[model samples]
Target: MNQIDFITEIQKHEPKMFGLAISILKNRDLAKDGLQESAIKLWNQRDYFQKVKNKQAYCMQIIKNWCYDELKRKVNNHLRLQDDEEVEEGIGNEKDHVNDTYRRIKSLIEKLPSKQRLIIQLKDFEGLDFEEISNALKMEQGSVRVNLSRARKRLKEMYLEQENKIKMIQNEE
Candidate 1:
């Protein structure tokens, strides 16, 4: 494919790519950087493109790897981003408050095991169909469904449990 075609192909998948990146990175700025990096990597490896049978899959693989590396780097550096912390702390009283349901959802999502979190984010928030989610995560469609269900179930349980605990405290007071 020529440069224009290559650009077009990547652009076609841009929305999905951005969603995947944000889900993985959990930071808009970082996700944008990761997406840019993915495109740059694809461009650099363009000569080998023909060797890969599925360009979309190949680009996804690249993004996944880059996200992993970026996450690793963040962990190693012990980056404590204030925004995520605020969300986690339920401090939505400010102008940036995302609302109770979404806040609870985000809280539960953040508490999920890494794999489950990613699955839920892709399926619930990004609106990737089962097949697309499976393809992106390299899990089977059934597995994706099961994982997503479990994630939602767990979130529901946690929310109810936490709500009860708060009620108990309030009653005691």
Candidate 2:
């Protein structure tokens, strides 16, 4: 791809890629840095872009790989820390139930196994089809679908269990 086309393509998936980075890194600043790094890497490999079938999947895979590498480096350096405040901004002093629900679901997702969590994020958040997810995750399409199904089922079960616990607490109160 040419310069303009390559840039346009990257911009098209920028938001989803950023979201993936943030989800993995859990910090806005680091996510931004990851995106910049991924962009530079993509630019360097632009010549080979012509051979890529699903550029979106390829972009996501790159971001995922880079984020994992960053996480490993941080772990090795003993610098792994939570960026709770920067994770999801504007949650302070708000009476928004939707935001609460979002947080709860996000936490539930975080509790999922690595493959299922990644598949759920890729399919639901990034809006990638099974084939794209399979390509990005390097899994079979059937495996991707099965993992997504299991993830959704597990999330629903967890949500219901939480609700039940809330109800029990209310009853005790």
- Model 1 Cα lDDT, one tens digit per residue, 1-173: 68998899899777777878877877777778888999998888888874777677677778888888988887899975333444445465773455666776787788998788998888778777887787778888999888999999998899899999989999999
Q: For residues 53-161, could you state the per-residue lDDT of candidate 2 as single tens digits?
A: 8888889899989999999999999996576552254766665676777778888888899778888887797677887678766889999989999999999999999
Q: Please identify model 1 stretches exceeding 4 Å from their true place.
A: 47-54, 75-98, 169-173
**Candidate 1 lowest-lDDT run of ten:** 81-90
- For model 1, the local distance difference test gives 0.80
The clash count for each model shown is: 0, 0
Provide the lowest-lDDT 10-residue window in model 2.
Answer: 80-89
User: Per-residue lDDT for 167 in model 2?
Assistant: 100
**Candidate 2 TM-score versus the reference:** 0.86
The number of the candidate with the highest TM-score is: 2
Error of 1 at 77 (Å): 5.7
Predict model 2's lDDT versus the native: 0.84
Q: Can you tell me which runs of candidate 2 are displaced by over 4 Å?
A: 81-83, 86-95
